[model samples]
Every structure is written in C-alpha cells, then in structure tokens.
Target: MRALAYFKKGDVHFTDSLPEPKLTSPKGLLISPSFTGMCGSDLHEITDGPIFMPKDGETNILSNESLPLAMGHEMSGYVKAVGPEVTKFKVGDRVVVEATISCVDKHRWPNAKNANTPMCDACKDGCENCCDYAGFSGLGVVSGGFSETMETIEHHVVKLPDFVPMDIAALIEPLSVAWHGARVAKFTEGKTALVLGSGPIGLAMTLVLKARGAKKIVVSEPASIRRELADKFHVETFDPSKHGERAIAELRSIPEGGNGFDFAFDCSGVAPTFNTGIAAIHYRGVYCNVAIWGKGINFNPMDMTLQEKNLTGSIGYTVEDFKQVVDAFEKKKIDPKECEHLITGRIKIEDGWEKGFLELINHKDTNIKILLTPNNHNELD
Candidate 1:
C-alpha cells in the first residue's frame, strides 16, 4: 500500500511498500480514506518529536504497533469492508473516525501487554479521552488514514450524512476538539465567548461557538491572515497586538454589558493568552485552555480566586463530541459551506511530504487545513 508515513523521528515521507491495514476485530471496518487533514501536531512530529509517536524501534503501549505507521487522525473515508459482526455500517458508507485509542480498546488487541489490565478510572466513567493510556489511532496506536486504507473498530467510527462532503468531514476531528473544549467549559446557548488566537483550533472554536448559539463570538489573533480567516466565519475579530497592555480590557468591552465574556478559550498556549483569557472573562466565567503547551507558565492563583472564575483545560475528544459535530452539520448549525473556508488546499498523498507537511511548516500563516488524499474514491482529479 502507498502511504505518507513516519519512517522514524524527523523522517516522514511517501512510500509505496507500506503494508495495507487489516480489520483486527469482529466489529472493525476497513476504510478507504477520502480526505485526511494535515495537522500542526503532525508538523511537530517532524520538528520536535516522537512526542506522541513511538520511537524508531519501539511500539505503542496500547496498540503494540511500531513506527513507520501511516500518519493522520483527522480523516473522512468510505467503508470498504466490515467484519462479520459489524452491524451499524456496510460497504460504501461515508464516515469519519473519532480515532482516540485508550485502555477501553484492549479488546481490539487481545495479545497486547496491557490487554488484561483493568479499565482506567476515566474509561470506567465514560471519559475515554482522559483515559490513563490515552493515545490516538494515527499518532501511534495504529496505522491511520494517510494511506491506501486503514482499520478501526466500530466504537471509533461515525457515519456521515450524505449532505456533508468528505472534505468537510475531515474537519470534524478538529471541530470535535473545539466542541470538547466548549463542553468542558459548560458553554451554553446565548453565551458570549472570547477565543484567543484564530489559528486552526481557534477558528474551529469560533465555528463551534456559533453553532451552539453564542450571542457574540470574538476571535483575537495577532496574525492578519488568521484574523481574515476568522472573519469569514461571521465572528468579530480582534488584534491583541494593537492594544498591547490594554488587550484584555478591549476584549471585554465587545460583549454585552461591557463586563466580560461568559467564556474565554485560550487556543494559543502562551502566557499572554493564558493571562488575558482569565482577565477578559467576568466573575464566575470559565476560561478553558485548548492549546497544547510545550512548557509550564507561572500563574497567580489570586486572579481566579478573587473573581471565582473557573480554570480548566481540554485535551482529546470523545466519540460523543464527534456525533454532536456531525449532528450540528446535519441540522445546518455548522454550515458545510462555511466549514469549506478552513480547507486551504488539497493534494494527493504522493505529494503529502513536500506539499502537505513542509508547506504547512514553512508557511503556517497562509493555510488553515491542507488535506491529502490517496486518490481513492476519486477525491482528487
């Protein structure tokens, strides 16, 4: 099978001899990927990584899969085959995968080291995203969608509505990340939100806020290109660089009552965004960290203490988030055409390395989501 894979640390490339994936469980489905989005995390695996990816010679603790795996988790595909016991989907169904792998998935790898271990507390409580051994399918747990085909059990697969195009379906994974952040923040309809940084996840947070009926959605980004992208989603855009020390105060004035936002999400994992997010929200408001930080930042507990503001962070998402995002699209809450604005480019898997990965690394501001296809299902011309 041809694939774009992580051959080793700092060595991802396109290859033709990678083995085709197989359905390992009775409820599994074989998927021919239609579109797979390139993510910032994928770029990290090349520059600063093996972070979530297994080291060159080691295997993932959960899946027991080694390196050189196909490298994408944000994917939309068509069902190619199903195991005998798979009942929910059949051949030719359009779908997107939730892709989170955790201790609850021990059944899929009965021979693995921890297969017989007890379920983690998080999984037992139905929070697989927070499982003790949480990892993603493409990140390291299993071969993922940047290939000829990939396989995952029914638990991770979500059926796509006919109205949602495959390209738009690939955005569901990131949207689910934003959805989970909003869920963690306990966001509600008619609440105003302040989303810091209008990068991919930041823009995604904007769309989710709109779909959930936010009274006002303000995206604060320093980059002009990203602010332009956020504006296309029909949200208010702010440039924090212009205000310097007064950024937080200016952000608070945008929402009704001029007090502060009901919720603020820091999609940019920096100290400034972190502090600004907390200060920009009103008393008892929630501030959720949605970005992946590389290092720790100093914090003043008194900030949250005085205002009774809540501080929390969201990581990977559950299958339920994927379902709700798809439902949002089906009900026209997340307009598919609006979602199209996030897809900056599309390329064949053969060009995934130079055109997909490096393009994002070299010119991060110019693109949002760049999708790659194996050319399966005629997704590419």
Candidate 2:
C-alpha cells in the first residue's frame, strides 16, 4: 500500500513501498480511506516535528508505535474488513474513526455506567482523553488515514449517516476536536464567544458555537481571506494587526452593556493570540486553548487571578465528541454542503507532497483545509 509518512523530524513523503495495514487486535477494523484531510499538525510534523509523531527510535508506551509513521488523522472511509470480535459494525459500513487511543477497556461510557473490567485511573474518572499516556492513533500509533488502507480498533469508529457525503464525513474528525473544546469550555445556548484565528480549527469552532446557539460570535484573524471566510458564517471578524489591544474592546462591546464573551477559544497557537484570547473573556468566563503551541508564553497571573477566570486546554477528541458531531450533521445543525468552502483543494495521494502539504505551508493564510484522496480519484461535487 502507498502511504505518506514521516521518515524523520523534517522528512515526510509519499512512499509506495509501505505495507498494507493488518489488524493488531481482534477488536480492530480495516478501512479503505476515501478522503483524508491534511491537518495543520501533519504539516507541523513534516516541517518542524518529532513533536507528537514520535522520534525515530523512541516508542510511545501507550500505542507502542515508533517512527516512519504514516500521517493523517482526519478522514472517513468504508469498513472493508472487521475482526471477528467486532460486532458493532460489519463490512460495507460507512464510518469515521475517532483517532484517540484511550487507556480503558472498550464499551465504557455512552452505553454502560462503567466497565466490568478495570481501567486506568483517568479512565475510571471518565477522562480517557486525559489518561496519563494516551496517544493519538494516527500520530504516534500504527499506519494512519493517509495510507490507501488503515486499521483501527472498532471502539474508535463512528457510523456516518447515509446522507452525509464521504468528503464531508472526512471533516467529522476536526469537527469533533472543536466539539470537544466547546464541551470542555461549557459553551451553552445564549452565551457569546470570541474565537482567535480563522484557520480550520477556529472556523470549526465558530460553526460549533453557532450550532450550540451562541448569541454572538466574533473572530479575530489577521488574514483577509480567513476573515472573509468567517464572515460567511455570519460572525464578525477583526484584524488583530489593525485593532491591536483594542480587539477585545470590540468583542466586549458587541454584547449589550459590554459584558464580554462567555468563552474565548484560542486556536491560532500564536503568542499574541494567547494574550488577546485570555483578555477577551468575561469575568468568571472560560478560556479554552485549542492550539498546539511550540513553546510556552509568559502568562500574567493577574489575567486569571483578578477576574477569577477559568483557564483550560483541549487536545484530541473523545468518542463522545465524534458521536456528537455526527449527530449534529444528521440533525442539520452542521451542514456538510456549506462546509465545502473549507476544502480549498483536493489532490491524489501521489500529489500529496506538492498540492496538499506545500500548498498549506506556502498559502496557509488563503487555504482552510485540503483533502487528499488517498484511495479514490472521484472529485467531490
């Protein structure tokens, strides 16, 4: 099987010599990927990595995976084969796999109150996403969605609605990330929000905010194209370069009596955005950090101290998040048709390096998401 993989920290390319994936556990399922998204993290891994992709020699104790790792986590595909133990799904089922690797036994939450089998302490607390050593399936684990075929445990698979297009189903992964962030921050109906950045994650955050009935949504983005894209979602946009510290002033004044946003999500992963996002929240408000930053920023304790604000960070999504996103899509809360704008380009696997990865690296300000058709050549309508 052909796969785009990370050979070293800064080296990643498509290779035809990659072997076809096999199930490591009887609980696993094989998927022939239809559409796999080129995530910003994948670009980070290819450019300045070894961050989450695991270094050449080191193995992730949880996933037990090392390097030359296949890249890609956001995708949707059909179940071509299933292990004998996989009873939840069978062959020919359209599904989106949640990429998180939990420490608990399968069949825990969203069904039974608890697992009859023992689980990790974090998993026991219903925080498998925060388990001590949870690793993402695609990043540091086995072959990921970027390959022609990949295998994942059935516990991570979520069945997609028949009405959802395969290309749109590919977005379920990132949408779940945004959904999880919103869930973490306790975003509720009638609340207001300020999202920092208009990249894919930020845009997805805005859409999720809207779906949850956020009264006012404001996005601060420097890029004109991204700002315009946010505007299409009916949210106000601010150019941080122009507004500077006054960006928060605009966000606060949007709501009556200048109460400020109930939640602020920083998806830009930039030092400056971190300061602005924290300052934009209302007193006692929640600030969710959704970006994967390279280094720590100098955070003023008074920012959260005086205001009594709550600060939190979000990483990968849980199975519950994936289920919520699929439910939203099925209920028309998130329209797949409108999300087509997020796909700036779609390329074949062989062209992934130039069209998928480099296009994002060179023109990230203009592109939102790029889909790579690893196994199929059909153009998304």
Candidate 3:
C-alpha cells in the first residue's frame, strides 16, 4: 500500500511499501479513502513534532503502533469491506470517519495494554473525546487515511448523505471541531458571536455560527487574507490589528445592544485573542477556547469573576458531534456550496507530501483546507 507517513521527527514522506491496514475486529470496516484534508496539526507534526505521534522506536500506548504510521484524520471514503458483525454499513457505502481513538476502543485492539482495564470515567459517561487515553487514529493510534486503505470499528464511522460530495465530506471533521466548540459554549439560535481569528478553525466557527442561526457573526482576524476568506461567508470581518488596544471595545459594539457578544470563541490561541475573546463578551456570556495553544498565558480569575462570564475550552470532538454536523448538512443548516470555499486545493496521495503538506506549510496564509486523494475513487477527475 502506498501512503504518506511519519518516518520520524521532521520526516514525513510518501512510501509504496507501507503495510496495508486490516480490520482488527468483527465490527470493523475497511475503507478506501476518497478525500482527506491536510490540517495545521499535520504541518506541526512535520515541523516541530512527534507531539502526538509516538517517538521513532516507540509505540502508541493505545493502538500499540509505532512511527512511520500513515497520517490523515480528516477523511471521507467508500467502504471496501466489512467485518462479519458490522451491521451498520456494507461494502460500497460512502462514509466519513470520526477518527478519534480512545479507551472505549479497547475492543478493537485486543492486544493493547489497557484492553482489559476498566473504562475511564469520561468514556463510561459517553465522553470518549475526553477519555484518559484519547488519541486520533491517524495522529498516533493507527494507520490513517493518507494511504490506500484504513480500518476502524463501526463506532467511528458515519454515513454520508447522497447530496454531500466526498470532497465536501472531508470538511465535516473540521466543522465538527467547530461544532463541538459551539456546543461547549452552549450557543443557541439568534445569539451573536465573536470569533477570534479567521484561520481554518476560525472560519469553521463562522460557518457553524451561521448554520445555528447566529444573529450576528463577527470574525476578528489580523491577516488580510484570512479576513477576506471569512468575508465570503457573509459574516462581518474585523481587523484586530487596526484597533490595537481598543480591539475588544470595537468588537463589542458590533453586536446588538452594543453591550457584548452572547458568545466568543478564541480560535487563534494567543494572548491577545484569548484576552479579546473573554473581554469582548458581555456579562454571563460564554467564551470558548477552540484553539490548540502551544504554551500557557497569564490569567486573572477576577476578570471573569466580576462579569459572571463562563469560561470553557473544546478539544477533540465526540462521535455525536460528527453526527450532528452531518445532520446539519443533510437538513441544509450548513450550505454545501458555502463549505466549498474552505477547500483551497486538492492533490493525489502521490503528491501529498509536496503538493499537499508542503504547500500548506510554505503558503499557510493562502490556503485553507488542501485535500489529498489516493485517486482510487475517481473523486478528483
């Protein structure tokens, strides 16, 4: 099987001899990927990583897999084969993989160290996204979609609607990330939102807000290119750099009543964006951190104490989040045409390293989501 894999630190490339993935459980399904999106996390793995990936000679605690694993989590594909006990899907069905691997998945990896261990509190409570050993299939748990085929249990697969194109289906994973953030904030219809940074996740937040009926959505992004991309969604775009010290003040004035936003999501994961997201919201409003910060920042408890504002942060999404996002698309809450704006480029798996990964790293600002295909399904004519 040909795959784009992580060989070691700063060493990811395409290889033709990587072992093919197999269904590891009776309820598992083998899938041939149609399209998979390149993520910022993937770039991080190539540049400053092995963060989530196991070390060169080490094995992932959950899946017991080592480095040189195929890399791609945001994927949509067609079922190629199904284990005898898999009743939810059959061969040839179009599907999208949720991609999260956790303690609840012990049944799938019988040889894992924790296979017989009791379920973690989070998994027992149906929050596998927060499971004690939470890791993504592609990131570390096992070989992922950036290959000829990948396998996973039925629990992580979601069926795609007939109207959704395979390429658009790849966007569902990122949208689910934004959707989970909105869920964490307890966002509701008609609420105004302030989304800090219009990068991939930031722009994704804008789309989710619009689909959920946000009265107003203001995307505060410093980069002109990103702001331009956010504007395509018909949401208001704010250049925070222009306002400087008064950025939060200007952001609050955009929503109705001129008080503050009902919800603010920090997708940029920086000191300024974090402060602006918290400060720009009104009393009792919610501020959700959707970004993956690399370091800690100074914080004062009194900031939220006076306002009674709620603070929360979102991490990996649950399977339910994936279902709801697909429901949103099926019911027309999220327009597929609008979702197309997020896909900046597409390339074959053969060119995934150069045209897909390197393109995103070198020209970060110019692209949003770059998808790679194995060309097995003819999704890329």
Once fitted onto the true fold, the runs of candidate 1 whose alpha carbons sit more than 4 angstroms away are 379-381
Across 160-236, the per-residue lDDT of candidate 1 in tens digits comes to 99888889999999999999999998999999999999899998999999999999999999999889999898778
CA RMSD of each candidate after superposition: 1.2, 4.2, 1.1
Q: Tell me the tens digit of each residue's lDDT in model 2 across 220-279.
A: 898888899999888888887886667668767776679777889999888888877787
Kindly indicate the candidate among 1 and 2 with the higher TM-score: 1
How many angstroms is residue 298 displaced in model 2 relative to the true structure, after the best TM-score fit?
2.1
**Candidate 3 wrong stretches, greater than 4 Å:** 379-381
- The lDDT, on a scale of 0 to 1, for candidate 3 is 0.90
Model 1 residue 192 distance off true place after TM-score fit, in angstroms: 0.7
| Candidate 3 TM-score to native | 0.98
- lDDT tens digits, residues 304-323, model 3? 99999999999979999999
Local distance difference test values of all predictions, in order: 0.91, 0.82, 0.90
Q: Point out the worst 10-residue segment of candidate 2 by lDDT.
A: 107-116
